[model samples]
Target: MRLRLLVALMGVGAALLCAMPAASYAQSCEMKLGAMGPMSGGAAQWGLAMKSAAELAAAEVNAQGGVKIDGKQCKVVVVPYDSKYTADGAAAGSNALAAEDIHLIIGPVGSPEATGIKPVAARNGQLAWNAAYAKNSLEPKFPLMFHIAPGPAVWADAVIKRAEKEFPMKSVALIAPNDQGGTDIVSVDAEAYKANGIKTSEEYYQRGTTDFAPIVTRILASNPDVVDTASSPPGDAGVIIKQLRLAGFKGPIGRLGGPGTAEILRVAGGLDVVKNFYWFETVPTEDPKVQEIDSLYKKLLGKDPVGGTAVWADLPAARMTLKAVSLAGTDNAKAVAAELRKMPVDDPNIGKGYWTGKKQFGIAQELSFPFGIGIIKDGKNLGVERQPARPD
Candidate 1:
């Protein structure tokens, strides 16, 4: 009887040991979020900023004992990948992240790169927060994908409306890359200019066409009062601006997106050379909240913030996603997406944004954040001149 009782006790001990790790798993798990972008190529500045922003968000959440999910505190970790700003690179980088079991992917910013991540993200059941300025970035092709930027119509109504009041847009020359990107950008410009009683002449140039002499001359012959570089790639936009300046068009240089200030300065030798240029993307760093973010970013990344990019929006986007994780009560993609649909426009960086997309993309996943206007003076970033004003 004694031996049999001892044998039974040993059996119970084995069962307890087996149950131990299964219980502990709830206490020691980490939720991995992935970020991919061009950390090495021309868009490195933007990419690095994105990665840093995610890291900052993750750090803050982890410090607070992580995002509570499944009745457990799952620490969020941001894993970054460099996509080289190419479609192939984005696919490969995202695949690598999926292999590591990362569920939420942030970035792969811009055009073809942002487009390529859709399939990989969908296949892996990963939620993607696309921070690109591309036309198709917010398309409903991927049910799990979300856009955190404003749309073309939103910009046209705000940026262009403000431009009409500030600059002489009666005769504006619009130039962009001869691609789908240009089409989307110019489409907004056309509608906005027309609404504001401004006439616009649009000219498209093929990518890699280095000679802007003829293009600039044709643009000048039209005698435009404002030159719009809405969809020109960074390097090309800078080249066009420098050439336009050389050709003596003393009008305002403008974009609905960032004008690639570093590249523009590099190509044009600005900072006491170039005059007025306006952009629609910048953080109102004067606000104390933005100032804190700015200081933290500089300290964490060992670099100062760059204007005229999505640097301001990326951190806000991350914070918004994390907020949904808490409100959804679980980290499940669809549940978090549902909560995201109801997220408020409280992020100070991107003012007064709400989640709305059903009318535009057949899904309620786009964050309509207010965009700020930036003015460049004496070739230096003057920061935001005005915030986006939405119609009632």
Candidate 2:
């Protein structure tokens, strides 16, 4: 009886030992990162792209044994929130994510969301990167807020010059949503066009307006040489383009706003419909290194990334944020911000960039990368031309 009891006790001890590692692994360190944007609606592409970039970054870090936090390798888990491209939506999303103890956010992709998330994120001790072109995207008071890329103020003049050479225009009418997101970018674009000695007119419509026929009629009445969709969501821009064409306005169409050419093409009924188009491409996507981002995303995430060039533009921010988190040795937002500010603006895929925005935003937290100008002349895709980054 004593020998049998000893054997049973030994077996119990072995079972406990065998179960220990699995339990510990299950309870291992995990860092939750927040990714916010409009995951639905017309702006879904941009938001989804931000989420995809964050996931790819997290995957890349996890593959290398995860991020070292407090001496333990912590696996990153991305918690996404669809901000719905509104101010209140972003503010609420920040609070919701803060409740989950997530201190870093990948995006709130529009100007209104940027405006809304800033104060809430600051109060929550969160560091959020906003890809908004708002006039005040990064204020000195909100040091934790970071800009994903330089706004139109940085590249609009260059793009305008390139577009002017291709499609000479005397007067241009700019149309956008009647919100800060639209007004801010359109105002800057207007200035750029005016500076180029071109006459400019501004048109605004309420957000969520599907039919732009009335607005198109009003715009065509001016008989402008060009119509610039300055920062309208791609879906809205496509509809506007279609209506303008139907209204018998055959002038060149320019998009001096966000990068959404692919979506615009799909929504506007392809290249044939959007003939004589000129727009901005956030990166020199034609480069072999830049083009490699898609393959890398596929290899890391086991899926094709959406959002076209926007994903490539957003990836560096996510990658650098992870690097900062690892270096800071904590998920603390303030600590991560300090490390991020100190790190150089370098990405293997995007090449070198600058930490601009000191002059524009009163903070040097904006990433300025080499951009490109895409053209579709006479219904043929002319490809994107790479332009070097300008110094602040």
On TM-score, the candidate that comes out on top is 2
Residues 68-133, candidate 2: write the lDDT tens digits.
789888888999999999999999999999999999999989999999999999999999999999
- Candidate 2 lDDT at 256 equals 93
Q: Which stretches of candidate 2 lie over 4 Å from their true place?
A: 1-27
Instruction: After superposing candidate 1 on the true structure, give the runs of residues whose Cα lies further than 4 Å from its correct spot.
Output: 1-27, 69-72, 133-135, 205-214, 259-267, 282-285, 298-309, 326-331, 348-351, 376-383, 388-392
lDDT by residue for model 1 over 261-297, one digit each (tens)? Answer: 6566676667555577776664444455665776766
Which pairs clash (backbone N, Cα, C closer than 3 Å) in model 1? none
Each model's lDDT? 0.71, 0.91
Structural RMSD, model 2? 4.0
